[model samples]
Target: MNFKFHHIGIVVNSIEQYEKQMLPNKKVREVIDKIQNSKLALYENFNESYIELIEPLNENSTSFNSLKKFGNHLNHLCYKVGPFSELENFMRDRKWIKVFGPVPAALFENQKVVFYLNRNSQLIEFIISE
Candidate 1:
């Protein structure tokens, strides 16, 4: 049940636009996750933390509504978890509802990820640790 801070997810109109303006000259890994219907970019900082920039692939994308409502803004916090099986019980105990996933994420080398919503409606993402 160990959880480690992994990254912050930000919804943006375009990952390329955000990278060019904010992460210029920084190395970034980009991928298209069809399961999530979004384009993603991961930038790892010197401190080993990461920032995940997400852009909707189309109007049907899950992120599309979020982007339209919040514009370019912080979307969620992600954590790396060691034991995937414990996630359900852990989240339920805290009154968090599963919103999306437990699906393979293209941006994470096909690793599984799950999304949850807390009582206050804040989103959280959990990626199964390697």
Candidate 2:
């Protein structure tokens, strides 16, 4: 019954490109460098959680090439919660379309996250941390 809306993912041609065109005078480069040092940076009333910034890793990655295919838009938003299985069970009866990831045992020890694409325009991610 509790969750924190972590961050929103916006797909752009490039963060640098967006920063240059949208925020011409701001010291965006310095801000980005500071962020690289801390991974997550809290701004005004929002927290920025960066996965990777320089390239399109997968077909699903938001980058110049990928965004052209997916369309420049908000890719998704992640919410942090406790006990993903319990959340899954609770939401199951409500008819949400659950797709991909409860990453099974592997040497990497990655936690599972769930994505649900419903009638909503945004892809929702349930981030489960161990």
Candidate 3:
């Protein structure tokens, strides 16, 4: 599988506040600090691996919905993986069952990613960086 532990995704209420509070500790590396759309803002921090803060822009956003339901908690765990096809087959063969994409990702230019939900409802995000 060659899966490398990537990041822990967290849903937040405000990106600006979160960035101010967390981004300046002098230990973490900020890979991306971007407001992707009205629905999302992505902040990626790398201390050893990564930590992604996803702030919601509206009630209709995934982050808002998740924070409403789960209260600004750990949303998902991502793993850097190989090509999409191989990982898709690997997960399918293991019966993990894909719950989200093999779609174009916002992480990097031309990056593709996917999500698999195991029996425990634990999410496994796979990123295929190009």
> Please, what are the lDDT tens digits per residue for candidate 3 over residues 10-30?
777765666676754332323
Candidates sorted by TM-score, descending order? 1, 3, 2
- TM-score, one value per model: 0.92, 0.58, 0.76
Off by over 4 Å in 1: 23-25
Residue 17, model 1: Cα distance from true site in angstroms: 1.4
| Model 1, position 78: C-alpha lDDT score | 91
Top model by TM-score, which number?
1
Scanning candidate 3 in windows of ten residues, the lowest lDDT window is: 29-38
Global lDDT of each model? 0.87, 0.49, 0.67
Tens digits of per-residue lDDT for model 2, 45-88? 22443322232334443244536677546567767778877778
Q: By summed lDDT, which 10 consecutive residues of candidate 2 come out lowest?
A: 34-43
Candidate number that wins on lDDT, 1 or 2: 1
TM-score, structure 1 vs. true: 0.92
Superposed by TM-score, candidate 2 places the C-alpha of residue 100 at a distance from the truth, in angstroms, of 2.1
